[model samples]
Target chain A: MSSPATQPDFGSARPGGRTARTRAAVRDATLAELAAHGYRGLTVDGVAERSGVHRTTVYRRWGGVDGLVVDALDLAGEDGWQPPDTGGFAGDCRALAAEVHRSFADPAQGAASAAVVAASFQSPRAAEALRGFYADRNARSEVIVSRAVDRGELPAGTDAAAVVRAVVAPLFHRLFITREPLDAGVAEQAAEAAVAAALAGVFQLPSGA
Target chain B: MSSPATQPDFGSARPGGRTARTRAAVRDATLAELAAHGYRGLTVDGVAERSGVHRTTVYRRWGGVDGLVVDALDLAGEDGWQPPDTGGFAGDCRALAAEVHRSFADPAQGAASAAVVAASFQSPRAAEALRGFYADRNARSEVIVSRAVDRGELPAGTDAAAVVRAVVAPLFHRLFITREPLDAGVAEQAAEAAVAAALAGVFQLPSGA
Candidate 1:
């Protein structure tokens, strides 16, 4: 639930003041390095050199390059985008879908996500972080669906988790495999389609229950 | 459509009769090396030494390690363990879902797929090969869903592509992210859920239309 913008600023001077400035500089350098060399090629030493921070300070704050990458992803504000809380399930899904499309379409986000996904394949810590990121999105969508269920718009015992997966799987597929530019309109259509399916009992209660 | 058992033996010698035995040995060596060293560490000379094939012959057949890896994957076969054809939509889904579960649960397949996915990140040809593999699976599912649509078991304009994705997405998520085993029962439930939702008009037609 921490917004990416408010994550510990790696470049800002810490409470010791000087440390804060160094942290901010280190974070900025990390962003630049990630954009240029990708996650596989990034190193803590490179970030320290680029930011004029001590290697010890960089390590002390972030643990290592993987931690540094996680913080950088956080600092880069990749988690700030959220779907509008539209009243209806369809509207909420559309909003969520559109937001996903816009985020994946953005060059910065797409590159960062790709880097995270690639890194996750090799690193347990990175994999956990990436999973946490997606789980958060899934949780958000679940709330909306639950609300619809409460209002009796959806049948009881609907699998909210499955519904969330249904909504975003296409967007993720496009981002990871196809590398296609996901647009708002496409997201809207996908969202509408998903919601329509869910409402119709495609991902609903089991039989004879 | 090829069964894993019937694919051309990459291990067999080439058309020159005597050369065919040498080629099979070389290809088998390559697979062993890949399983041990992965894509980054595999080398052509090592394969030649292991298989006792001449280095020139290895080069002539595969061009290099990348080509060899591609062929290894191809020779591994394209059969995704399709579900049996059941007349009902739910039955068809259950069959495919079980197949996915079986494939991913197989240790050999799971590891091989992970390696291929990682290698695809670095090799464009590998990426294309991986895409071709999945595209074939998706196309097969699409045909099943299309038949259901024809029987009016699903919406007239059901998004077969989306349905196919929904069917397989959970299994992939479990395999890659959750590291969970996809059991037959889970696959059957997932299929039934998706099919039921689709029948209820979740994915097709406009929202509230």
Candidate 2:
């Protein structure tokens, strides 16, 4: 997986062409198949059939199911989506938490995410893809924490990725571990807890360590 | 899935007998198969052969792979394992974090856990089993927080389960999400952050909530 601090520019818009459209269609199909069948059950033929793309085209272009799945994850966040920045760090954290809650609480999108998470545990390649997806997402999200630090709301040298992870960890724990209901209260508390932790410098790394 | 607060008595020990021996063998085989082939690839026949137990016996006792998997998870923590408690709440939290880190970073145990987590996302039955396992584990560990509260370290209304979840959430996020290295520093930080949040009353529910 790519380092969280040094990620390649992911999800760049493709030039308008037949290839771009076909790729978009294939990404949709891959996500659908993943949600319906999970990573273990998904196959190239199934995706090609569902996408209405030729099997040969999928096999040649994407190489295999792993590539397609990676692309699917990419498509979900590659629209240059930035983390929420609502001026104050607390508000920004709340907005980011709300966004994560919405995505995981949405049935279709949640299923797709659960499928990818399950698949990652089984396959190393899938794990790498998931890691890269998060790395890229966090890379984009660091700005929120950076801005907070610049405003003197947080201590210098605070790890932005740690802060973001702290905000979202409880939500994921409830979603994937406890399988609990994720409502507005949970999201608000998650953001609040992260803010509290960050303010205490819990996310700070040892200097020069 | 069982509610986190109310879980069935998990991992109760059986008396010395042929049944106990058979069950133990089956549990071992189930973990091996789960680690080797994952939940998706696990099969009754594979388990029966691996355990050298008759296929009929395996089928009659376990019902199916999910049952065996649940039973396997049960055996892992059935030894009445308790979270570490070194007087202070911070020490107890640190011990709990260390325990979680050791389990997840251990190759064989981690792979088995990964398999169960992966499988749970794919199958509803598996999800139920995984939820039950965590519910039982957390139910057992809640005493740590209760002790702290009684010691006047935390407010009386601190949510014990929430505190425990906070202690382990970031570790799981790393274990299952960003796929970062699970080192001593990370574990120490996870415990420290959870302690900080709990002290700040982040885990407290609203009055009457």
Candidate 3:
């Protein structure tokens, strides 16, 4: 598959051997379908046609639309993504929050991201795949908190994942839940709130609990 | 018309005359359809049958499934919903967060609420209804911050709606975006984090900005 590489921030499956290329091709088609027509419009034949793979091969490999979405999510999780490293915890939080805004609110990428979220609501396997994908991301983001602890910037026991969640939650809430408008201050304010909470040790777990 | 009143925690339509009764029945049926089968399964005929209203009347009034959802959401906004008032700002934050957990995580109401959110993603009118609903809710919740300012518990310049957003954003993130598991600590810790941030004046907007 050609590495199309449309967007630079969000991960894309790397080009490799024939099998890997096929997988990447199928995943790319799946995401494009989702972005353009949403989950309800995805079909096995559609993906096969879009990917230029044989219909029988596509059906046998993916089983169905749910399978396609699940596999695409799994592939996405393995793409070696990392959080920003800004040296300072507050700065890192701001960078991470802004990144989320760009990834999920930007016109180029937000539609596909939103469609996947909507697909999860429609399919149990898609929801599970989404859960696993985010779990991997949360684990990867913990390095930001660990570095802060090492530099004496935050409490030793601060919950790294919780801090990450705080930094991005308001943006997600506005984008998905409340359907509110977002501006430049939305990301900055959310990051600042997370920084303040982390400084107060609000995320620190009780010892041995 | 009977004021079935299945759940008490989330608001129910208030007692009223015949017009209100018809509206309540249709709203209840619309919510039931959304809860049971989600937005995809809701239909004008289904709502009409479930509501015991004529199909002609349902079509004439609601137009279609999206219209049914929009009307239900509008009616829900009209219900007298208020945030918790537990005296202390911290206590109120805890209560408000817990209220969100109960309303959105409880199996009885969560499905319907989730369906509405999912519907907004699929329909422009539904999105508008969801926006209006949350805007009303956010405005109502501002009292929590205003009271805190009045009692000198938080800075006078604090953004009331911003504080409310902080209190519930994390819970919505976990429940919807990441599909993460929620426990008792989820709501309490979220409230604590928001309280810490608010106390630090992180939510205070610049003067005249």
Candidate 4:
């Protein structure tokens, strides 16, 4: 493992501060545990042990496994999350789809995601964390739509977050419910379908009905 | 509980007969167990006791808990499974979406469905059963697209099953992944967006692409 001295801190008060380093270590340990054992088997002790933090510190800081998982999820959401702005709606949608597909299709990330989804079913807090995580993700991607509107590729009142959700939701269905084959083609289909539907005002909430 | 005699069999041979009665009892008991205890907590002995079938009979017929759940799923899929023929693609899509929403949104049915989905994650046989159930459902709904094709609303050679999958996928995402509140409005949005995407050739798999 690389030493903390070599690691870059994006814009922290102290580049190699003990608190930030400890937080990073704990989050990494949480993800590792989630990927290895799934949420059902995850434990605070395991995370504390793997993170090399005191058990009391772990318990005092996170309070429980759900808290730790939520923190890990927040960290995951923040890192490398900006969707590519390919200048148009279709390109942006496709880029975002591809990025999401790759993340969810990778073995480690896939397992971590599945673990989180499974945990959400058993706990209301996990469910809320998942919703918050996706909401943030969708919000970050809304720039794609704003750019599309500026370029006159879509109408002024298109729901950008809905468009992003539409593009990603099918893949989530396949991964979590249908368990279907997910490939580049699937990503392309999701992007194209969302683009088509958004252009047609299908995602725009109707005035009355 | 009503007598088995009161339940119609929809023209099955030996309806209300002893064997049919036993099967119905077992399946209903299985659903109750699933709803009460979830997939991991389900047991063959528990089902046998609740179903009033002999332990040997339950063991001999279903082989185990997973087998019992699969058989229960088959029974669930077969009963009252038809979507309304609303005479046009959009109407048919909306009706089918509403039906799915109702079934999935009902408390008992929803809990039972969640148990099975959870089981699928841990058992290959359960996964196969889920895939088979959905394949049959998609086949049943293909007529909607076929009629649309006949009416020249959708292009000829549209993949009927793909359209159906697209239409229903967002709801599944909400039910299983996003854990979002699913209302009629959400159902309507899913159906309308799918219809719009289908018309734009988004769901059509390109030749050699």
DockQ of each: 0.32, 0.68, 0.78, 0.61
Deviation from native of the Cα of residue A29 in model 1, angstroms:
3.5
Sort by DockQ, best first: 3, 2, 4, 1
Residue ranges of candidate 2 with Cα displaced over 4 Å? A1-15, B1-15
Model 1 Cα lDDT, one tens digit per residue, A1-209 = 22221112123222347665565577677766766776667898999899988899888999988887676545443434444567888887776666666554556655555666666665677666666666665665587678888888888788787677656665665555533446765566557656766776766657612
Query: Order the candidates by lDDT, highest first — what do you get?
Result: 3, 2, 4, 1
Tens-digit lDDT track for model 2 on B128-176? 8778778878878899888998999998878888888888888888877
TM-score for predicted model 4 compared with the true structure:
0.86
- List CA RMSD, all candidates: 5.4, 4.6, 3.8, 5.8
Which is better, 3 or 4, measured by TM-score?
3
Worst 10 contiguous positions by lDDT, candidate 1 chain A: A1-10
Give the TM-score of each candidate: 0.78, 0.90, 0.93, 0.86
lDDT of 1 by residue, B1-209 (tens): 31221112233223456765665566677766765676676799999999888889789988998887787656544334343568877777777777667655556554555666666666678777666666655665677777888787876777776577666655665555434456876676667656765776655744522
Give the range where candidate 4 chain B is weakest over 10 consecutive residues by summed lDDT: B1-10
The better candidate by TM-score, 2 or 3, is: 3
Model 3 regions more than 4 Å off: A1-11, B1-11
Top candidate on lDDT is: 3
- What docking class should model 2 receive? medium
lDDT of 4 by residue, A1-209 (tens): 11011011111222257987887788778877877887777899999899999989999999999888777666655554466777778998887778777766667656666777777766678778777777676777788888988898888878776787788888887776767789988888888989999999876645412
Task: Pick the TM-score winner.
Answer: 3
Give candidate 1 regions above 4 Å deviation.
A1-28, A73-83, A178-186, A200-209, B1-36, B45-55, B76-83, B155-159, B177-181, B200-209
Which CAPRI tier for candidate 3? medium
Range of the 10 consecutive residues with the lowest summed lDDT in candidate 3 chain A: A1-10
